[model samples]
Target: MVQFSFFVLPLCFLFNSRKIDNENIKTLQNDSFMRYINLESLYLEDNKLTTIHPGTFSGLGNVHWLGLMGNRLQTLDGGGICHDAPSIRWLSLGNNKISTIEPHAFDCLSQLSDLNISLNPLQSMDEDVFEGLDRIKSLYVYTIYYTDFSTAMFDNTTNLDHVYFSKFRYCNFALHVRHCEPNSDGISSLEHLLARGVLRVCVWVIAVLTCTGNTCVMIGRSLMKHENKVHSLFIKNLCASDLVMGVYLIIIGTKDVVYRGIYNRHALEWKESFGCQFTGFLAMLSSEVSVLLLTYMSVERFLCVVFPYRDRRPNVRQAAVVLIAIWLTGFFLAFSPLIGHGLGYFDSFYGNNGVCFPLHLHQPYLRGWEYSAFIFLGVNFTSLLIILSAYTGMFISIQRTRRSIASSFTTYVGQATNGWIPDIQRKNLRTTALSGSMYAWIVIFILPINSAINPILYSLTTRTF
Candidate 1:
């Protein structure tokens, strides 16, 4: 038994010595040192190396820390740290000449918790450079000179907590911090204060202009004793939609004010209040419904001119049905996100406002569901095509109608016994065509502009103007 024990101990020591000797031999060759050594820590400082080979740390599975400071590396090659170095927890690449980091440069260091890349000459970092680094806890980015931090820069990281941007020398540097905790109170306070002032002015402006313009249009049509009830109904629907949109604008203004106040107070319950949810739902629903209604109105105008005698003109009943459909569709689309995802309570980074925005579909990217890419692309493309097609078709149809009217009036005048018939008919046709065309143009252009501008103006006004 004694002899056996003594022999086993000697064998164990011999094995350890052999491992050390192998590592010692690997350190002679720079590449082999990374490949063969069971190194727990590596220091590659003060190297004259200007570029690192791809997969430089491909086989360093046991490496727990790596320091590549004081190197002349100008760029990190693609997949420079390719191996699954799960044990690596700390990385220091400070004092390097790295000017650019390729996307996915640090793809394999999932276990990394601390990273220091300070004192580097890095001028820029790609948006997806740190795409898969969800586990990173502390980051030190001290000397990056030229990089704009937009929403796209931190598109992937959701778990990042502490980030240090020390010694920044550039002016007007913008750093967008994404996926941080919701600062509901801070955002709510600012929004509420702004909203109170803006809502008063918006309510007054929208009420006066919309009411006056719509009332004049309605009265003018009535005074003419318009025979076509469909045209009158179309006018009414347009006015009604505009009025509803304006009311929603007021609601949105108030919501912004309330959200800011609640967020500043750090009232989580208030932030998630039913009033907030209802307001969000109503705003989204109205905005979407307005778009659909505007589209419907455009189509109605096109049909009235293109096929006037088709006996298919929409009456008040039909218009109501169409409006209801629009509302239902909008409600379903906007509220669907709420049922599947969480409430649309998101902190706005634009002005540090805490109001309910749309649910961030990109939140699940780190969890393996890449929904944001497809949704963003699909929605924008579809909307663009729809809007473009509608506008093109409307313009083409209007031009054809105008030319036909000009030719018809010219021919009618030559055969008319009364000179007044040609003049009267021409004037009437021109007025009708101009009115319809102008209305369509307003729907296409003015509505979007109004939606965009109302939010800002509503936030600044102090009284209901």
Candidate 2:
């Protein structure tokens, strides 16, 4: 029952314990751990110890796990440090100042399974460095400096199943092994980089254009002297949605740039931070809001065209309510994963690409989120149908109205103005047709194009790319 933690001293008192968890202890003498002969595990990580005395772990026969990560140890001397520790299995000397290792330094620990010396400044690596780790299964050796991984570097590690090295290629063997990069999703680093480079350029350009186009639309509508109140409102809402999309694109584009340049592979900072989840949620929210607003605008236009007698315009208060509802629904849908109703969990490794992506419908164990995906598809399809039907009805109504007017005018003018009236009616009809054609293009192509590009941009970001 001896509990020691965080800089506890007196080797005599800790000798009775089977585990010693005195991490962050700056001073560890050669004999400090000698008295703990029965110790099964020792955690001395995050300390200031600069070296390991020849016999520091001489008598810890039963120690199975040794965590000396985040230390200042410069060299690991070849000695009988763990000669008595026959049961040692896991050793973590990661994030240390170990620049080199003496031959057969760990030869005593023949049963070691995992050796994590990652983030160390080791000058080189060879078979002698892992002389005793014949049974090592997983080795993590990520570092800043370059190691040419000579033929003999892994000769002693016959049982090694996985080796995590840097993403940079030093040799053909490095390429064959699993390498961790900023993009940890399924895609390879080269493919990820290629796609990201292209996306970085495209997204920024699209973002700038979207922002400018949407802003101009909003400003023009606002400055108009006799703006069509109903049409103006719909345009404003559409512009607002596009603006949100533009902002989201800008953020992701900037992140891509940073990841390629300054941050490199470490740019996956979003994986462990709240930024990943928040940004992902916000992006989804913006997209959903834009889609819903588009639907509302199309239906509003439809009502105005079909029922021209009544006032189909919504006031500011009514508009506010609808916008609020749309936003609230979007928010709920976007963040449902946080409440266990969607993906059923908030996974930082959602796509394993370092980007906090929305929960994919194809992901496993999705409770309500799977159904939510179907709902999204249904709404989008229904909205598109409404837009198409509305625009079609408008075209038919305009054509009928023009023909009726032309007939009445021809009848009233007899033969004197019949030719002139027909010509005027034909010109008017042409103008209406042209206008409808442009509206159809916007609905059938432009709107869908904008929405389509966003997902395409995202899909290009394979696995966390």
Candidate 3:
């Protein structure tokens, strides 16, 4: 159903003109341009061309530029390209329903310098999909697909120097590509993830202090003779949990350094990597175990102060069992996402962010929201309540342990369980929700401080009086 007035076609072709566009061109028949030998450019934009049969462009001589944008082109197959036009350098096939590009579709157009394949529904592409385009230099890609594109998609395009991708994540695979546009995603840049110099320094400082403080506490506990061995054991385990937090921070800081400058290039790969998953697991394990350990200690202190006459404290063997159980529980909770991922419960739960921290504050209802909600609202909220009650009861009796209670309360509250409530999970619920500010503050100061403050809060080597 191709319609075009042949009245002025020969006159325009005689003058070596460039436009056959803005017409109701539904299709092109074989040897459509056989007589137009002088035509150097052809623009068939905004047409209803559904398909092009073999030999449609067979005799297009000297045509170097072809613009087929804003068409109903579904597939790029045989006979669409000029049969003998080796001079065709610029080809614009954008804004079409192009989901497939048949083999050798562009084999004849070896001199094509720029290819605009943007705004198409091509969900995935094979590694060697652009096999014949040896001289392709610039590729424009902007798709609605979320698939992980293969890194070797442009390996055969050896001359390709300029790549324009809509998503920053795709920049990683375009190796040897000289120029890639839109490299920054606001929070992450080539220089750093935090985007601010102060936060970058703070991450390293927190990591060092957290590890140093916990290590000192552990060393002092082992060397000094504490009157209560069970108390010493509890303190040792708490320090170990905090040490894990420090390790998590150290890993995060290292990753930021390793990926600085070219952050977007490796952003997606790093986020979906095993290292990120493990780091996030470490964060969860450390944070939860630390909270639980503090709760246990608070209750132990509460029993000693309020019911001082009663022998409610568990023996060393029972305490050992409790520590083992607490660790196992933390491990299970942290590792649950990995297991649930296999069962289709999550997709890269731990690898959701650049820092590998699964805060989900940006979009709380995003993928795996239920699992995160359970961890934050169900487990963490309950632990906070237990710790608060234990400290409150103990403070009423002795009034001396108020200092320890306040520090522990502040530490647990800093985890930000208030943001996890399902009722207000939406960021718009309050008009301003914590995004990177909460993540930055927690990672730099609050989260690491859990282990950093243990040595100060509960001095195991010293008398508990």
Which is the winner by TM-score between candidate 1 and candidate 3?
A: 3
**CA lDDT of 36 in candidate 2?**
68
**Candidate 2 residue 266 C-alpha distance from true site, Å:** 3.0
Top candidate on TM-score is 3
Off by over 4 Å in 3: 1-11, 14-36, 46-48, 82-86, 144-146, 185-199, 217-238, 255-277, 288-319, 336-354, 357-465
lDDT-based ranking, best first? Answer: 3, 2, 1
Tens-place lDDT digits, model 3, residues 7-101: 33554447565676668788676666777787788888988888877766666768888888989888876456745565688888889888877
Q: Rate the local accuracy (lDDT) of all candidates.
A: 0.46, 0.54, 0.71
Off by over 4 Å in 1: 1-228, 231-248, 255-273, 342-355, 359-387, 394-448, 451-465
For 1-465, candidate 1 gives per-residue lDDT tens digits of 011112222222112111221111111222444333456776666655565554455556777777767766778744455454556778888887888877777776778778888787777787777777778876777555443444455556566665656321111121233212222122122124223344335444654565455455546555755465654554454445445555544554554445454333332343345554554455445445545554554455456545657986667688777767876876675565456434222222111112333322212221112222222233323443454454455456555536554333223212211221222233334323222222222222233234433323222321111
Model 2, 387-418: lDDT tens per residue? 55655665566546544433332232122112
1 against 2, candidate with superior TM-score: 2
